[model samples]
Target: MESALAARLAAAPEEGIAPVHFVWIVAKDRASGTPSPMGIWSGDEDLTVTVALPDGTTASRAYLGGLGLEVEGLQYVADLTDNPVTVTLSQIAPAAQALVRGLDVRLAPVEVHATTMTGGALTSAPQLQWVGIVDEGPISTPAAGGAGGIALSIRSEIMTQLGQVNPAKSSDVHQKRRAAGDRFSEYAAVIGERKMQWYKR
Candidate 1:
């Protein structure tokens, strides 16, 4: 089986080898509706998740979190499937706590248009590049630490046939345009500028 690291790196194109950047756009505050900047931080903690497979078995996995990556890198990581991803944040700050108080965060990093840990040589360090929605909740501590941070669990958007994107249907839609001979009309307009740019290429 392919290693998780291999799987994530596979998300990027062969030519992409730039440094990754982690970003988090804290959802707008419930009271003010104002969002937080994509705060970048080092010394991020590891991400762990418990995944239940199709068969009668379960597995626990971990990945590097608290890091950022551009869109290209993020896309690669987001392609990961069949497993749940979760992140744990330590040392909560008052301001950040406000943002995390009650919100589903958006992992919208910057665009990558162009583009871990200790122990021994055998030590494993995986960097998280996946981008998606995550559920957040507060963690309580009974120790003298007296404070804790939020834990983020990746929310899979996958669905059954009813909700899945039909590639064939998309192909048919594009083919219809091809058969239209590139004619533009008031009734037939295309939005999604980014997708249009890709389709044009």
Candidate 2:
């Protein structure tokens, strides 16, 4: 739990604190597959704010677009376990539907924050209750004047990472990216095909 939030819970304030859920998705662009940051929260109005992340660091200020996104099946557990979560975007807005369909959201980083609202505003830093990756995204398009939705299936981040195949390549360029002076892979390509006579007949 976040330090401020834990203290608030311990204090047991008189004022009511409403629970709110916030989601941060690292979505990707359609064409370039470039990363795009989208912040969403279950609130009545949009907000630009920063919050504490689970990695013991402060996140950059995020603009959370509200009133259209929904999160489901989120759980907080004290044990070491991971579960999948689902996120859906209502298809009431055409632009939202288009945006969902246009992006390549596979393996996108997903984070869900749980916090409280006091006096119509967020309390302290929200605690990161769940972390995952986008396993798949399915969009449903409706007919003329019908309502559909875009749903994202999220799975455990550690599980996803375990299943991911390393894309590292054995080449000079790729090796240089890891360490500028490394030349271990310089002759990797040429040595593979080079023939050597090692027998004395």
lDDT for each candidate structure:
0.40, 0.75
Root mean square deviation (Cα) for candidate 1: 16.3
Which lDDT tens digits does candidate 2 get at residues 116-200? Answer: 7766667776677778888878878889878878788888888667767998988999999999999999998889798878783
| Clash-forming residue pairs, model 1 | 11-76, 21-68, 21-69, 22-67, 22-68, 22-69
CA lDDT, candidate 2, residue 121: 66
The reply for model 2, stretches above 4 Å from the true place, is 2-4, 7-17, 77-82, 142-147, 162-201
Quote the lDDT for 61 in model 2.
52
Clashes of each: 6, 0
Candidate 2 has an lDDT of 0.75
